[model samples]
Target: MDTACGKEYECMLRITEEILLLILDTEQGNIRVSLPAHTRDIVIAGAVLMDLAMEDRIDTDLQQLILVNPIPLGDDFLDPTLADIANATDTHDTAYWIARTAERGEQIRQRAINRLAARGILETEGHGPVFFSRLVSRIRRYPSVDGTDMEDVHVRIMRVLFSQDIPDPRDALIVSLAASCGVFDSLLSGEERAQVRDRIDQVARLDLIGRTVAAALRQHTPSARSRKSARPHQQIPCVAGWPIAGHAFAMSRDLRIFLTRQYQRHGPIFRIKAFNRRFIVLAGPEANVFVTKAEHVHLRSNELWRDFDAATGSGRTVMSMDGPEHMRMRKVQAAGYSSKVIQNRLDDVIDITRRAIDTWPMDQAMSGFPALQRIVAEQIGLLLTSLSPQPYINDLTVFLETLLKIQVVHQWPKLMMHWPRFRQARRRVMELYAALLVAHQPENRRHRHSDFIDDLLELHRTDPQFLPETDLPVAFLGSYFAGLDTSASVCAFMLHVLLKHPELLARMTAEVDALFDRGTPTAQGLSELDVTHRIALETLRMYPIIPGLTRTVSNSFEFGGYLVPAGAQVIIGNTVAHHLPACFPHPERFDIDRYQRGRAEHRKPGAFAPFGVGRHRCLGSGFAEVQIAVTMATIVRETELVLERPHRPIDIKQMPLPHPAASFKIRQVRRRRASGTV
Candidate 1:
């Protein structure tokens, strides 16, 4: 090795870093040279190609690597590689060069290692293992600085990848190369992997050199070529269903059972033909992490909910927005559900719950779902608009139900909206919203800082351009739609579960009793009700309101050994994932203690996604939890309740939001002791 050439290589540290990253597993503190001999060679060769592209020595546009500048820099490693490309008599593409150069991957790896050792960045040691009268030599490499043990350089590479700050092109290329080769799994911890997984995806999209290298590798590798030849949609195992109509009926009948069966047969990633369309279903925690944590650039939320546009109103709501637009709207809307705001409104929530409870016909057995629905609607109405639920609650409920039914139909025919009931209900709901908007104007101010509507109005006042007068009603409608059915269903599920299990109910009652005994039902008091909180979490796990979250892929990506193409509708089944034995053992058993300190089953990433996850995690999560806790605690403290039909199971309809298949009837036994006594 020439000392002058090694000195010249110091200026091209980017190439050295890329080679080191490829040949060394910084996380494991070992050289990856022992793997398939060609792996390191191919990656090093790919890095050289990337450096060439970056240096403008070569250019690529969709096909062949066109050499523009044949003149090479003085660096020994890069110059020789450049000569191979520049002096070739035969016209070869990028893939050909990578393959030809990769033949000497081992030589390249040894030279890079020797150079790093010469620079004192790495220490090499030789050891021999005696095997059957023969000695096998093993070379071990470790990071060293000035002959002292030092941290691996890969950590800095990962830090650059994970940091919010943009990395230089060289650092980006190195990280992108590792990610594109799927080396991250061996280099990152499970938690760290989850954190940087999306970031890696983002980097892959940004790094042209890395993508070019990946494309070249795919073209060269036989297996990768086969995979590329097969269409992404054809790769996934589609669940057996009807020819054209597909699994629409089965899906509607019981989505959880249908999906679970498909998951069992086809593994975590599968496709189901339903409503004359193919939906790629991704189950379990890994899928959840992929879908939720994926960059918005790759997976978009807007297209998934296109059917709901008419019902949700044009671009007026946050559901239609994505990326920065969604973030801005969420920031403004989040103010209403912030911890401070929710605490201040605790009294309002409890008062509305108490009033609704007072109205429930106590002695006679009555439907639990409708009563809970009305109560939650009223509570949300008060919290959002500071308005009574009197005339509008029924209309709002009717509107939501009609819209949900239409949504389930999946075919958004224009004629369906012309139906009498659907039209009437939608008209009634719009009229109510219009009335509310009229009453909430600046001139019609009664209680200026009363509720969520007031907050929106205030924002509109502050930034007229951002929150136009036309959008105020849309924002209110969006919040109403987001909060109403989901919260009500969760509260109803809690009641249904408690009524069925007397022991859990007794435990919760005792816990709530103890909580109020400490002080009045303040926000501070409610936060301390651990058992009550656990019950809420457990119910959400058992019956996730949304069941599954859907998104449309905007960029092609690999998942579970299959290429998921762009424009595919991907379903991350929260209900399916929640019930997985791997995620939550004995998942069917409704046990609140699963969430307790010693047994925090919900702590697992993606194990519990009742409110969805990532950028679009339910904005009203805090408000919903507070509302459910206050409602359940109040019920447990004020009344004694029993299941109306003990033998009958709670018939749950898992769509638009999980609700009872039929009304759940519960009988009130008697009034409980005062708040002070358990």
Candidate 2:
């Protein structure tokens, strides 16, 4: 075909776009799971080459590729490959160009998807939330914006495959590309494929470009065994354990201990099986840096939290979204959940802490975790929405903990979500949020201080499509729960550590008393509490509440000489650095001075990640830290904490979130500062 003549046969979707549409599982919105991810890249590269051929920019015979015209296509995806072929001085075969282009498979795929999204034919959206469905939310979905049942390329391809009608040259190329990548294996079953076998081969021969693609891919595509042996990337080492159970029992017994041991034994990356599911663990300081760098590109978190999103009745949460949607929601809630919010309202936070402390019976052996949880919940209420959560603390705790266990942890049965206790707790928590919504109304809070809820309401008013009223509960509740679980547990651990070591406790006490000795605790003054700050840092490092992040590999990446492939479910062991002696000397010891100026072990990249790492690194890390520091300072300054059983070892409850066990009780033996005093 001549170059000018080929331009007359332009189709609705580009060859690359048509190939994408055909290979994509319409229901899931990602490339079909049955197709290897790399193969998708190779197919896309081939599509670019096919488009170039259609434009008469290039031509291929049985083996060698001939560059007829060196001109650009003006299309982003096609132009780059056209330029690459034009720039080459030496002659190369079709397989050479395909391999060269496919080397940038991730970039090519993303660019094609981005262009498709920009054209408005397809919209990028998350799996909103299904009640009990197994979610693969990690991969993105692109449903047609028109809401029509018929997908043009898919319908057209099937029409050609199942019938005797001849396919157009474009459709023939798509058929060839799909077959070359084994996409037919996923789209058509063995029986269906068997029926279409002769037709597919017949259609694939219609275009010379299609025949070239078929031949190049057949000759160059390595078998699974050859690819494994040829490439330096080895299989991730799996932790030795039983067939089905794997390390579930060991992990359930003590997660931190098991993870630390694995890091030491297996080095950075390894795999583990829990029940029927397998997870690859990326550990140590290097893994932390790798995750921080790769999070937005290669890893994602929304798929892991879809059940939690559904259980919240919000359909989606900021934590359960990726790409643009996640960023938009995160930006709306950023200022409201920041540490500056706590810094501005230091007096209110201190007052809330003091009042909660006063409620603790003076000489009674009260449970540490629950007591601290209630106090943190109260502070979150006052600071976040300017509404007290005091009455609904128990209800909120029950509701959040139950959903976490059932949805996030997968420890409890999903049916537990329907239990009456959870039902009532959820109702009460909703009532609390309902009250918050009412309290933040413009007329109701005319003179009241604007808060996180007010910001959410403002965003909803401006962009309801993005921040719908239905999602308000999760928007508010997400921030509250983050504090309730992570910040509260850190405070409990601080209490445990302080109670365990009298000298450290006394040093923290003196630091707190000195901070209060100055008029009011300014953010500057709170930040300067070196001993107290180190204790908080040391506590977080020693007792990380959320140890590792569970994510799906969005793009295949190489780490420590092993290739972590796309579509893998992985646990990035972010806290592995905290326990590694290389990152911190004598990591097991309770040494607050590791964070001191001279040592500053936590200053290293990936060495200290109590707030997690990467783009999803907790937005409220500053808030959590200040909350812990101030709460610890207030408690130490006001009353003395004595462990109920001083000699008993601190028992850890590791499921859902790790925290000091209820048996780790503390009683206030001395009151240095009265509840109502300055």
Candidate 3:
């Protein structure tokens, strides 16, 4: 019936009466897709697929597709063809291999049918069927997880039919993400839905494109099983049986171990899962494109805070706003903490650092981390215009090593928005800053002087739009909390590195000593020391700040020649990227010369971005660098450190641990040495 003709247009959804052949397709029934003329479009889905699948137990439905797409989109029916395609995925391959051992087993038969349809196993008019030899030839050209490694199953298939190559990984990944997004149809906005479709197209194109694709680009897993609560977040629906590896229950042991293992094995940007969200951890310069790129699809502070809340059970203590709102507040308030600006408070920084170091008893023999913590405390106070300017400086430098406990990490205050206590604590923290904010107003008599707070207050009064009520809490809370552990921990690591390698330390020391007298430390002297500058970069490369940073897609993102769906959480493994062969030459070797050496020009902008990238790039990067370099150089010039006792094995998971329950142990080696002297 032609609708254009205005006749009775019978939109026929043909329901054929037959013993419906419901083929169990993808592993664990994840990939179940219906053939065409079916009501649910492969592109569109409805209701909870698992609920419908289970309804079979109570209510009998005569006709069903069974499970076709292994990453089930809509419901109960599992079709064999697409499921086989998905089962060939990493997590499912073993099951597929074992199940298919029998001669033309049900699983294997369904697979051959789908692969034939997808790859033209038999001659058909729709695309144009090809013979088995053509299938072999097509197979040879297809992409797979380990493109280079021809697994036994693929080899058996090749030998069983004729020789054929592995299928493309991108093809598998596309089918996976597509089917994953198909669930929860009405909820996603029209634009977001389109973006997912566009990604499916891009991934399809990529799968058929070329060869030797990186694992981050090609390797992915879709979750096949269903959960009880079935939140929208879970229905993120893994496609192609892609690795939605582990979730809330399974996160503890596997997540951290998996991350470090990926770092050791895959370079960076491989996928990972945590608390039910699939995340890809990116690293090095390659990750910069996501963070610092013009595209602007990132996990804004508020989004990050949302996850933090999920983990912590609280929110709204600043660092949550995103896009123009975040930029507006930051622009108005940014000046107070700029490198040049923070430097004026350098007098404060120096005074605090000096007193903390000077008062230390030589015999105290503390860890480098403790000293770094003290420095961070000093920096925080200086940033805040610390009351009394001297006493609180020492104790405030807490080794927050305690904050990194796995239990605390899980109890993120923002997670339980429904909880009243969590909400109140957040309000209380914001209220504390609110009182301080009143004094920040230039017109307010309490803020007659031009401290950072006062300076921002003046700007707020001057610019009509600058007054975001949320700004005061965000800026101050952001600065205060940000400065504490990140800097201190890195400083400790850097000093420890220098102290361990005497020659490198001595070279750096000599450079710093030449700028001014042996022990006189200042920012100008630090600027003058090029060697010190070079070494600082090397130190960063070896032990970077924030092992990695996390981001979630506000909208869909196309990266590394693959389209990632909206709402998929991602972690840019900055440390792993730095260690990539493409980014750094001989990445494992810690040669300080890379930065200051002949190929010093090799260090590109986004390549070594420890402060991270995109719209959420670190605001305090320049400040942190100067602060670290000056402090480390100063300490080197003053005394040499000797590790009295080495630390127990460090937990890379809780890396960048700000404060430890106990201080590190090191003897101070003064220049005019007696026993522990330089």
Candidate 4:
């Protein structure tokens, strides 16, 4: 431990050599790595990562495990002498020495070995160690599989430890366990994901092992289904625009008006300049058919999502994926989110929503985003992970916010990958995510719940071969992240808009009261909230979370008479498209009346896509509507909200958020029971 003689550096170099010995246990697998040969260093590098996993310091979800290959190692990079590192015990010491003396291979080898050896699980020759053996034994004893073969268990445990999945019968059990422990999703390549698929098939092929298991796992595979080609879209006027940015762009309202003019002036289709890109805004039903229904002609929502990011911070989410890969991932994640699953957990969401809404400080002015974030996280913990953090709500909100900014807002430096800011953001997001995996996973489940985490863990255990792993968590996280802020803001907007126009509020309150008098706001009660639903829809249309959706043209295609260049990006303006007067009479007005009980005819087909459309449309739309409807109903039922600065010309400088401080106070009317039920 003494640094006085500067012998610490010399002492540190020897530990890496010791660590390498610990990583190689089997007689046949052991290989000499300290030599100056080029291949020798590379071999050492390969063992480093596996060694790290064996010790369990890093979880199975190590995100960048793929980076281990094309192993960056050489003799020059790993020049540590055996004498210099011999007495230096501990992984950090070995890593430091390796880092100091070795450039690549030695550094990796030292880090990997030390990570393991530091934990006191030194490798044994031709056998498992006391600590590792004990851990593995305990895991195997956990009763995940009833009849999975022993050899199969051993092989799977071995494969799982190295982040390689074994296809033996026990993989289902092991995968479930890994997911429960907050193991990160393995950054599996297409091949690895496929290999897992085949292994599951093998298990299914085993006679009388139970027939449905393999098929179940197969359902979760990204490549499970064969996709059909998109049908040819009917010809409609498809105008394209490539406008160079002028110094003076139109105001937000002007842009909205301009888009309306383009739709009106150009008939069914036209194009306009938006921000830095040229948006090809279309009108009429065919526009919807083209953008949403057509298969290969996928709708892009990045532009809309950017505005969303401005509010919710969710651009990097898996929901941001596009084209075939995007659709595949969505389908795999969707398998877990079937109606049966939702119906089973409807009560849980309702309970959580009620508590969250009750906790919403109506007396004092506050931001709804933080509270909404809590609901999102709570749902994720219950629905996906089965373990939601209670005291760390604020921290979780900030973390989610941080992820959003790092991803959606692109504020955390790494907006551009080449920039140092991006590097910092990368470090922050990765570290935050790793810490979350560790934090959410407490040992031996004293604090477990029947949440999504439990569901996934159980399924993964029962059918690891078919499990989507952490994608459920990711999807749930994404939905809440993608949904909460915007929905809450819409709720906030609705509250503001209604308060400004008390007649509308009175009508909504009466509708809710009528529905309540008949029965609780159950599935049937929501059907009666048609006027309320219209008001909600109109709010979404007028001040949609995103301005438009965009897609990068992946293939050369023709829309109407326009030959859209293959690489060109397409923009579908939702907000503007909604405002086109030809589509909606008196489009500038905030008329909830358009969708009211007496006036339901205004909802035209293909005209009202508040949540976008198609395969990748918001999966949480139903959930979000319930949340918003419930929250809005609760606030209206129990309190009267009043905007401090009463009606004058309230100018919305920002397109999405009317204002930041956005203060309001609510007066208690009467206490209502748990009246709303999904």
Candidate 5:
């Protein structure tokens, strides 16, 4: 091979450089001695395949890698690998080559390190006890004659991964390689990894080669092979009573109570035949960890919520999407609810809350649920659509309430949805949403301020594929549907909890008053109200609005000593987990202090599930938090509230949102004194 060809191979260090940096622990300045052998082999083998593709020596079409050139690349590390592929008599696929190459991964790894050492980019030393005889190396970044440190390569790669900069092909390949091997955690500290996780994930998706390699690994892994061969050992424990309708009626009546009773009888993992379908229910923190962390292929959200698709609409909202489509939509929607955007809208949120409070009758008793629902609906309207709920507030509230009911009892016969009253209500709600969409269009929009609608419009303008025109109305209604009822339920429950404990309410009131005395409620000021924030968190833990989350299992797996078969539906009950004596000690108590910095009781894994978890966690969590906190704080500071019927056990509705019964009433009187008075 000629020197120019050798130079070309030498300059193409895309794969090798990624492997070296990943294998090195930057803090310790040495090779990560704890790197597992199997993972290391898989990553190195993947790197070799990527390098070959980048060199134009090979290419893949769907299932197989076709050799494009048989000529030697003139680099010792790659030339032999190329030769092996060229000499193969049988037509081979990508996975076959990856496995074949991985058999010699240790040799490939050593040679790459030796090349780096020769270039003074790394220093090696004898490691382990004398008899063991192994080499340990540390990266060296000393400035070369060209005045560039070798370490700059690592920095440049990370910068490309973290920044919005469009990465060159090489850096994109590196990110794909790292993500495929699951080595991101090894390279970055937990905090640092979180900060750049989204960007890294975006970049990783760009590398088709890496994705193919990862898919191959998943298919051929020992676990996959064993799962394919093994049959489920025993039948999953099933809840008793109701064969045809199964446990559907009981589950819909009160999921928390039903699940808790089943848990007591069947332990952590059990099956409930519900709505003529079997659901595998997993409860507690261990179950939380297992379900949330399961592979996307093993469990999916869209399939679980399929029954509601007709009522909710299909392929038009975030909740209906799975995998890459869901992820892409989430990225676009995140812009509207980011901390910066929420902060910008904080004043509007506070003003809306204050207005709702002022309109409440001063002395007459009123059901807290409607008052809170009205306030929450108005606030969601202003923040999400930049529209006030004037002339249509009642209509909008009714629409949302009906939609929530339909979602909760969505399993009813298809004919029920087509009933005259139900269909009319559905049509009315869609018309209201359609009107909102039309009013917010670029040509028709009256308001100048930005909101979620504006953000989504911008996305649609820039990338038509990001959100289709048909989905515009559904997306808008979905955001409102998600926030309005859930927020109202939480706010009502908070009022109930506060009225039950006047002292606790007093402490929270003081905290809010102190913060507002400093200045108006800026995002920074609102965040400082630790007591109020804790109250919001504790309320959700005790009465999670959506008590249970369900998913469909795509791959069979073992959990809590039971084998959950593929194609089964799984339900994880947040209410059940929250009340576990093991998780929250005094399970029945409402202690806001549990979420205080020092206590942080909810920090225990799946103990708190108000916003759900993992990929399916509520997108509006930040929006929900800010909306809840500001509303609670404003009420505490501006009005003196007392339950009209005190000590009435809070009757929580079991289906839809865990709303307090309408009988829960409160009497409010405007504070006589000004800002700081409590």
Candidate 6:
């Protein structure tokens, strides 16, 4: 080969790289499983042989593989196989060399991945999932679920398969290699595969190396039953069930503890059937990594939340949508839901928090969770929706939690929606929504600064099809609900931890006092509450607000050698890793230092997913953190609260969501200073 031509070949993606990329399910970070196991290995081996032939190191005809130039290419993926072929004492056909090379498949696969990562074609963020990209820069591109911008191989292959253009020898060889391995099964849908099958066959016949690869793979292909039997003889363990209740009773008793026990016993992946709804439970750090890397391709959220969508009376909410549509909707509200939104209005938030604290009767015990929730609801309204939640807080709470209990958790009967109190609450909340809609219309908002509602209103006006008028009420209410509930839960938990650890409380108090001494807490000042920040993170690690997420498998994938097939319901125990001693040393202990620079345990891959993971990962996570820290700081600087008299240990109550039991109360010992005096 001419020197220039050889350099050109060097610049081009190698046949091995092309084959690996072709078979990779980029969205899932796994080789496509549409074909049986080890097919890619054979195809990749054929690629190595073909590359050798092209380089004049070997030649192949219908009957025999002939060594031409015995010199090695020095390519890691090809050199070993080439040397074997060169040193062979006896001659053999191409099929013999292909099978022998296939034995090195795992090593070949790893080398290709390492090369890809080195080339910047693939990237890894920290210890997170391998990310695929076609873009040249280092920016992270999370490809859309349906498909991403087609990489060069995909684009090239599709162009050749669908058109009348004559194929290049290299293209023809790739087509044959892919055809032999059934890669088209995944790269194309059924209709597309049928359309291109004849063309593929014609192209496969055009290259002698391709034809030999095809014949060999066809002869070696395992039968369907044998292939099924060949899969690893392992099954995900199932939790013990009780008659018709399945594992429902145990899950209801305390899901976090139950799941933690299951993780301890069965490791990360297991099965639990509850109320005729069987779920494949994925727990611990490893499962988090798997889901984070593959969720966009292998899981869908709409199915799991369909009942909640129906209960909303609106067609769909952002929480229930997936793929590009979900992304589009999330973009619509992204700015409004950001921490910057909360940060920009820190004073208003602090004011609302202070006012709520002032309402507590002096020296009297109050329900901690509900009291904190009410305060958060008020702050969420003023800052997010420009409404006062005081009049409608009870109504919003009752209406939202009732629907969540019935529709999301399946804790109550559908008939619970019609109970008189629920009906009253629902009616009041609808009225509240209606009022918000009217108040936020373009004309009515002349003087008011834009909030989340304004963003929705503008979108509804501009793109009715995208954000229809009918969806506004539910969207508005849902956004409000998101801010109110989780933030309060985190705040309550942070408070509990602070009270339990008086030394930590003292440290936090000292930190807050220092912060307040810097004048009114600016976003910059609030952000610098390092000790307080660690406390908040540690609290979240110990008592994650949303313990786990429910999803439905949209595509079949193997986890720990067990096939979690398509259409299975899954419970992602995302926060379970937080409690694992492997992920966090002495996890039950409230040690804020775990987040310190020396430890930094949460920085480990999938070790800390308090906001869950992947596409549906909590977008408001940053906002929640700031809101919690700010609230905790404000409370510490303003009032002295102690565990209520006849102190009872914290007990979690799970229904709509996990929160400290009603008996968990706090009494205000005294006002440390007048509200806002700090």
Instruction: Give the deviation of candidate 5 from the true structure as CA RMSD.
Output: 15.2
lDDT of 6 by residue, 56-79 (tens): 788776578888888778789889
Candidate order by lDDT, decreasing, is 6, 2, 5, 1, 4, 3
Query: Of the pair 1 and 3, which is ahead by TM-score?
Result: 1
State candidate 4's TM-score: 0.51
Please provide, for model 5 over 290-405, each residue's C-alpha lDDT reduced to its tens digit, 9 standing for 90 to 100.
55545344577776545455555544577767665765577567656655665777777677777777678878899998888778877777767776655455555555555545
Which consecutive 10 residues in model 4 have the weakest lDDT in total?
123-132
Clashes of 6: 0
* Candidate 6 or 3, higher lDDT: 6
Off by over 4 Å in 3: 1-270, 282-284, 298-301, 307-318, 345-347, 383-449, 459-471, 518-524, 601-606, 646-663, 669-678
Give the Å error, residue 50, model 6.
Answer: 24
Cα lDDT of model 4 by residue, 1-678, tens digit: 001112322222222343244333222222221222233343343223222222222212211121112322222223223223333353322223322232365345535444444433332211111122233334432111232212223344446544544443324333332222112123234565565554433433442211221122222222323755432332334344334542114524444445555566666555555446554445444565455534234344444344434333333334555544454344344434433344456456556756766665545555533454566556545654454545545443444555544554334544434455444544444444454455455474566544434444455567654444543344334434444455656666666677778888898998877765664456556656776887788887776665544565555555545555555555554455577655566878987767755655345555766665554556556656666676576556654546555654444433322222233433333345553542
For candidate 3, give the lDDT of residue 395. Answer: 25
Instruction: Supply the TM-score for candidate 2.
Output: 0.67
Question: What's the ranking of the predictions by TM-score, best on top?
Answer: 6, 5, 2, 1, 3, 4
Q: What does the lDDT read for residue 569 in candidate 6?
A: 91
Model 5 / residue 425 / CA error / Å: 3.8
List the candidates' TM-scores in order: 0.65, 0.67, 0.54, 0.51, 0.67, 0.71
| lDDT of the candidates, in the order given | 0.69, 0.79, 0.45, 0.45, 0.69, 0.79
**What lDDT score goes with residue 441 in model 6?**
70
Off by over 4 Å in 6: 1-234
Best candidate, TM-score-wise? Answer: 6
Please give the lDDT score for candidate 6.
0.79
Task: Point out where model 2 deviates above 4 Å.
Answer: 1-234
The C-alpha stretches of model 1 lying farther than 4 A from their native spots are: 1-231, 311-313, 407-414, 443-447, 458-470, 673-678
lDDT of 1: 0.69
Worst 10 residues of 2 by lDDT: 127-136
